[model samples]
Target: MVAAALSAETTRAALFLAATVGNVLGALVNYALGRFAIRFEDRRWFPVSPLARQKAETLFARYGQPVLLFSWLPIVGDPLTLAAGLLRTPLTVFLAYVTIGKAGRYAALLWLMPS
Candidate 1:
């Protein structure tokens, strides 16, 4: 949907804006899910186990905010953001780091792609 909207002649700018918004919103959604939906006791639907959550918390605690820079990575990235939210990390700081990470990832992708 984003690629298609970006490709369209009339709505290129709008589509790009929408894509950015959508990406950020997705991160927020992940955060919310991790905070409220995923439970340590209920592992069936959540998938992430208590041990995994503890590991992630430990890693994030050790690494600090810099861990947000990896928010664009596959598999682990989304979960990391969610864990951050679940941990109740400061919202402004999380958003700033996440936006930078996400923007960098998109910019790199665009640069690597052929025109």
Candidate 2:
């Protein structure tokens, strides 16, 4: 928000792009964690509790892929990204929706911020 709000005219668009890209990359990390980390979930030291994982899985199962549009949300967003991986969402589809949602969010922020 600060970066979008305070960026100079020459760099504002670049900043916005950077922010969106960074956020999407972070989500990718989360997705990778979900995809690659699930084997350890059966172990005792895994981060998320079983109930939390179940809830995330249930939400993903119920809503399907379009639900990823909400991945720009605050609390629910990160979990949904991870859930996408855990549930075996196709990579291309995941990137398309996630990029759309994340870029849209940054675009909105840039539009709303005062010049």
Candidate 3:
């Protein structure tokens, strides 16, 4: 979606700003979902095993802020952000990492695509 938008006749500044804003919004939504909507106790919805959550918690504890860098990975990325939010990870730190990760990911995608 972002790539398509950037490729349009829109001004470069506008495209860049849109992409950045979209990425941040996506991360924030993921964080909110994990923090409020999904419940660990609610097996029907979350369905993730206790062991998995424990592992994720341990990874987050060990990695601290850098874990946010992996927030782009398929399957794992969204959950990681959500877990970070649920764990009460500092908002500033989380946003910083998420922004960097998302920016880098989009930048790479933009770079790789044919002009």
Candidate 4:
């Protein structure tokens, strides 16, 4: 990012694209992992209780989209994407929200840098 900020305008744009694409790809991976975890959801050994599951589903249904806008958060961000996948958030929706959040954060940081 510092390199980009210190480089030409085109370089900054390229760096922004690289950062956004890479971050989004990572979010996709986490989402995929969450999707994979679902295979074990119904197993007797699964950790979540039925009531807990229902409550989680309810919360996600109600607030998931809005919450996803904050998926740019550091440590907390990854789990939000994972939860979105576990709750069966559509791919397009996940991408849109995750991209917006992540890209917005990067954009802000880049903007904050000296030109």
Among these predicted structures, which one has the highest lDDT?
2
What are the lDDT scores of the predictions, listed in order? 0.71, 0.81, 0.72, 0.76
For all candidates, the clash counts are 0, 0, 0, 0
Candidate 4, residues 45-97, lDDT tens digits: the string is: 64444555555456567786767787787656766776787878899999999
Clashing pairs for predicted structure model 4, backbone only = none
Please say which candidate is ahead in TM-score: 1 or 4. Answer: 4
List candidate 3 segments past 4 Å from native.
Answer: 2-7, 11-13, 40-55
Better of 1 and 3 by lDDT: 3
Candidate no. 3 TM-score: 0.73
lDDT of 3 by residue, 1-115 (tens): 5556556867545665678778788878767766776655456665344555566677788888798898777666766777787788788888999888877877776666566
Worst 10 residues of 1 by lDDT: 1-10
Model 4, runs deviating above 4 Å: 7-10, 38-62
Clashing pairs in 1: none
Q: Write the per-residue lDDT of candidate 2 for residues 31-67, one digit (tens) a residue.
A: 8878998777777865456676677678889989988
